[model samples]
Structures are given as structure tokens and as C-alpha cells.
Target: MTVALMWEARAVEGRGADLLAWVRQQPLADEPLRRDVLRAPQDRVLVITWWDAPYDADLPELPEPDAELVTRAVHRWRFEALPEH
Candidate 1:
């Protein structure tokens, strides 16, 4: 099975670019099949990582950055891809 992990956070005031750079520098415990980094209008950043793992397997996730970097707590979600129709 494959799992997709999504992590998102909105930077404080004008710290969007700084936050993005911080996240890019952070390393993951395991290498992902693919990864994406997105930026939103409100100084928000979204990171998506695809991994090969069992549906219920415990996977390493990106740790939240320092509290001062963001406007609020980070949000995360995980989903298992369904078989093709």
C-alpha cells in the first residue's frame, strides 16, 4: 500500500519565505517516493510526501518547526490510496 502524508502551516506575518526555507532544510527519517512543497496566498506552506508502507504502518513524519515561525499549530493528514477502478 501507499500512504500520502500532508503537512501544512501558515507563517507569521512576513515569515512565509523563512518558514518555507526552514521546512526545506528539515530532513525525513525515510526517503519518500515523491515530495511536493506548495505555497498559498496567506503565507501558508503545504508539504506532501508519498511513501511505500502498509495502510496501518507507523511512519516517520515531519516535525513541527519552532512555534514562533507560524501563526497557529501545524495541521497534518494521512491517506491511503485506493486501487484503481
Candidate 2:
């Protein structure tokens, strides 16, 4: 089975670049099958990691950034991949 973990956060005003750079510098204890980092308007950053594991299996996830770096707590979600139609 394949699992995708999503981590999203909004940086403090005018700090989008700093937030993006910080996310890029973070390291996971174990590398995932694939990883992608993205950004959007309003200083939002998103990270998605794909892993080969069961839905309920323990997985490595990005940790919360420093409180001063973000506007609010981070958001995270996990999903199980489905077969392509």
C-alpha cells in the first residue's frame, strides 16, 4: 500500500521566502519514496511525502516550525492511495 502525508502551514506576513527555505532545509529521519514542496499565495507552504506502508503504519512527518515563523499551527493529513481508474 501507498500512503501520502501532507503538511501545510502559513507563514507570518511577508515571510514566505523564509518559510519556504526553512521547509526545504528540514530532514526526515527516514527518506520517503517521494517528496514535494510547494507554495501558494498568502505565504502558504505545502509538503507532500509518499511512503510505502500500511495506512495505519507509523510514518515520519514534518514537525512544526518555530512559533515565530508561522501565523498559526500547521495542518496535516494522511491518505491512502487508490488504484487508477
- Pick the lDDT winner: 2
Question: Which parts of model 2 have CA positions greater than 4 angstroms off?
Answer: none
RMSD (CA, Å), candidate 1 to true, equals: 1.0
| TM-score of candidate 1 versus the correct structure, residues matched by position | 0.94
Point out where model 1 deviates above 4 Å.
none
Give one digit per residue, the lDDT tens place, for model 1 in 32-77. Answer: 9999999999999999999899867778788988999998899999
Model 2: which residue pairs collide? none
The best candidate by TM-score is: 2
Q: Candidate 1 clash total?
A: 0
Q: Candidate 2 at 38: error in angstroms?
A: 0.6
List model 2 lDDT by residue over 1-85, tens digit each: 9999999999999999999999999999999999999999999999999999999989988999999999999999999999999
Candidate 2 lDDT for residue 4? 98
